[model samples]
Target: MAASGAVEPGAAAATAAPSPAPAQAPAPEHLFRPISAEDEEQQPTEIESLCMNCYRNGTTRLLLTKVPFFREIIVSSFSCEHCGWNNTEIHSAGRIQDQGVRYALTVRTQEDMNREVVKTDSATTSIPELDFEIPAFTQKGALTTVEGLISRAISGLEQDQPTRRANEEAVAERIDEFIVRLKELKRVASPFTLIIDDPSGNSFVENPHAPQKDHALVITHYNRTVQQEEMLGLQAEAPEEKPEEEDLRNEVLQFNTNCPECNAPAQTNMKLVQIPHFKEVIIMATNCDCCGHRTNEVKSGGAVEPLGTRITFHITHPSDLTRDVLKVTKNPFTLGDSSNPGQMEKLREFSQKLDQILEGNVKAHFIMNDPAGNSYLQNVYAPEDDPEMKVEHYKRTFDQNEELGLNDMKTEGYETGLAPQR
Candidate 1:
């Protein structure tokens, strides 16, 4: 054995194994790249990886970007040189929404087909005209156009066709006829309805008319079913101990309730949440496992406000397409008999004015009349000042108070005040 403090120089080299090369620290990875408040342009990073198709060297490019007026997403594309196969997928970097969203768009124009669509892996796509549906979890998430979605589905159906033709002639013939019909939709021969239902609420369909109602597009947000919660892995494990009182606002409180649809008993999950600069509101969501019915409703949690609130906002360009605002649709004006030339001229003038607003050539005012004062138009510069928004509080009228059932409400001396009415 070598001496404790002294070793033969040649012996040490021969006895000891070669030191392993210093391992390099891996490049720090993040699901999404940090971006600043201003608009940003993100570039893709390319890496060499093994191809899943041919087991050969392939190139994978990753792009972490934020969609305009939307959330951040990671887009990955892989291409194999040997097999000439390629694939792409999009994953949202944002948190799961509290509710699900369904988008139905009537595709009537080429521009409609060119609209950008974000479909999550857990989203289902359907065409009502064709009675065709691509179920959730069957395809990866995508960031593509309406036409691209249909084209991809067509390609997927055709992939196994050659084998089917050799083995099952009858099946091939039926599919061929279906393929021709799908091709007709691609050509925009007639109007079709495209529906995307996403339980995660992470999917999106671009709205050409923002800050205004789109007649051809109808979007509804609803509570997810119990099964959807499990499928999305959002079923929170019950706490071992009871939730503390201090955290009641943050805790999800479940209460026994009856389903409004089938009258079956179920549970309604509720939480006290405060919207920014808005009053605390209770968001109650109910799901009935018996009838598979789901419902979401928001209730103002405090006493009626003393005064009503009205917000008048100047609508500039409709870029905030993702904002969820209630747009009440009503007829602009009643049309008179077409035989009257005077009424026809008035209608034509009104139509041109509407066209100007929709074309972004003229600005419009969007007003919100909230009697409860809790409802509000979202302020981008909350806690600060926004030049475009004007908020005013006014005393409710007698009719308004009657409608709210506040005619007999008394802030002071309610006990004596009610005796007179009795």
Candidate 2:
């Protein structure tokens, strides 16, 4: 070795036995904390990786767990036995939400600063009052408290300050002044605003008074811009112009969603479907690998029509009751009379007829009403129409919309500042 600590040209000729491996150091058990009865199912998966601190092989354990009142997340804990340094981070394990979410919190008290926050890697955190921001992708996502987040920012701001003070005195002094403002935010001096904008809609801030409106916190949702879409890697490529009929068959689009029953991450396959003599609609189907659950929904252009929800509800009911609602497809004959006794007898008659269709050699018509006009029952025999099978779209009545809880959202007196909850 030279005086300046440069290695000699023949240093490769030197040989020595490597040091023995250190005893494995375990990570804190808090990363796998039990938040629910199913927590035992979430075992941590370990992977060997190079530790950032020691540049040596270390273990990284990842556990997928569900957070109460929130969603699923994967907690990662890394430990290096050689350096005795460990770090933990959390990543969202749930599906991306439909719309972007923005949270603006007014931190007024110490309790406010203690509020929990789930900031995803794609989320942007900013203190508007100080004009400071931690841009998206600049820091790893975390499950932490507001005070803990501020302390982390302070540590980052003060990192390598001694060198800066020695070499860049003026820049160091300005940074010192900024650090004081960050400390004041933690002290809740005159209150400050903390904002988190997540285009992926995965970030969240706790509401101490959950189920009740929190005046100190404001949450809003909006669609993401084109630039935001590109940043998120969700931007779809421009399609080549072609005939309208060829648009759907050209590609099968897949989107990420969640299983309705288990809420596990799932993928939804979608393709445009055309019903003869009707408008085109998109059909999406989800099959969960975690749980043996499957769901399919149809959309004409906007929202998912209510027919799917009705089908889901009917499947939950017993046979007799399900037959009553499902009679739209099985039996079209009306049950006579509005009186309770007569209706009961009519329902009894309908049930018996349905059993007859199932057991006897009776041919019954199968008529389906899809609100999005996505159903197709092609007529065979050249151009001949099939009278037994019909596919149709019907206008949902106002009462049906009310049954869907959509009509109940209307506020007639919102200008008066008070609208009663329905």
Q: Which regions of candidate 1 fall more than 4 Å away from where they truly are?
A: 1-41, 237-299, 302-366, 369-422
Worst 10 residues of 1 by lDDT: 1-10
Positional deviation of residue 185's Cα in model 1 after best superposition, in angstroms: 0.6
**Model 1 shows how many backbone clashes?**
0
The TM-score measured for candidate 2 stands at 0.53
What are the per-residue Cα lDDT tens digits for candidate 2 across 281-328? 778899988766887777674454544311111111122132323342
Give candidate 2 regions above 4 Å deviation: 1-43, 237-422
lDDT string, candidate 1, 137-239, tens digits: 7777888889988887777667767888999999788877887888899889999999999999989987655434679888888889889999988775575
lDDT (CA) per prediction: 0.71, 0.64
Quality of model 2 by C-alpha lDDT: 0.64
Model 1 RMSD in angstroms: 20.3
The CA lDDT at 252 in model 2 is 77
Q: Count the backbone clashes (under 3 Å) in each candidate.
A: 0, 0
**Candidate 2: C-alpha RMSD after superposition:** 17.5
